[model samples]
Target: MSTSWRDRFEKNFISPEKKLGLDEILEEAHDAYLGWLAASLTAFHSDFNEDQVDQLDRIFQGESRIRSIANDCYNYAINGRFRLAKDAQEQEQMNDDWVCLAILVQSARPGIEEFSLTVRGRPIGVPAKLEQLLFHAQIRALLDFSTVDGFDEESVSVPQFFSQPVPGYLTLKEIALLGQMSERAVRNAAQPAAADRLQTRKEQTQTVVDATEALRWLKGRRGFIATRAD
Candidate 1:
């Protein structure tokens, strides 16, 4: 049988046979979990590429909960108490992360979608794509609880542009996509009279935002991830 995520995690992270210490286990949890998730993706699709794996690593590394829970799971398992209720909760969430990962795989391997559907229950609320989930998670992580105010249809729109290597000189539409804002909102923000106006310039007839200003503007917006360091 293929090794399950639980089994893989225990073998590599818990390392019960080797009797590693808590600090040792926690120190390697992030990278170990990255490999564990990559292995999970490989289980679903053999053709999964490095770029996709790197993207997955980046997404979950930025997500603190993943490493925290992996460390907790390791800590509890070290004491031979692997079946705690909290570990059960963590496992359930990990399953959801795997499902989200399957969505990422779906573009390259469409058949994975059918497999994902088999495992998923009927949607309980508004359905979200993986990008939206990551965006919202970033918001919750970086900002105060009270600052995360409201959501609308646009709020759930994928920040697809944020995934690029560098967000150099974005167009109005690109800025809109990156910020999950409507074109009208992005356009208004670029105007000279607008409050906190973006540093924009006309390239031929169309206006574009400088990457530096773009980052500054996005820092204040909800669901923005600084993929590139300033």
Candidate 2:
């Protein structure tokens, strides 16, 4: 008779005969979760060569919540409070869970950032003026929020351009220099939150602006466009 998961837990996972240290298992799982993100990004962005992929993966490892959760799960599993390895297949099941959660994070990142700016934009700290600039009604006309999920509409090779961010955008610091204001002032003014998420991570919230669009935006703010329209 083959041993069951519950049986294996009784025999080895909690016993002195365990095959691997809990800490080692946790580290391995954490690496695998971040590695999954690297793999997905590589598929999404051809311009993100191996070196760039590796660099981003390292950054995510440092910042992501996924790794932290996995570490916690492993520690709990080893203490006999819960049983994950009653059988040979249980470890693989835990890995699948990690992978699924990582993908969910990758998929939802764009939407989350957009929502953050629209709702909780304060903590991220946009210059107060720029904040209003970003959230102005006309801003959506200048900033695009959609993503390409597939090429079913395409009849040829996918446009490599999709792998990168749309051009004509600048960071807050750049905008500050162009506006001849202190960066702090720019952040203080940066408000209203725009949709700034990306499927390929081309830009982050409060980190991108369109100088030309901003000029147009400022005109409206100053009543030039309003006056012209009136």
Residue-level lDDT of model 1, residues 138-192, one tens digit each, is 2222221122232111222222211222224666655554555666787888788
Candidate 1 TM-score, true structure as reference: 0.34
* Shift of residue 107 alpha carbon in model 1, Å: 3.2
CA deviation > 4 Å runs, candidate 1: 1-103, 106-109, 112-116, 120-128, 131-167, 204-206, 222-230
Deviating ranges (above 4 Å) for candidate 2: 1-18, 54-64, 82-230
Against the true structure, what is every candidate's RMSD?
A: 18.4, 24.3
- Local distance difference test, each candidate: 0.42, 0.35
Per-model TM against the reference: 0.34, 0.25
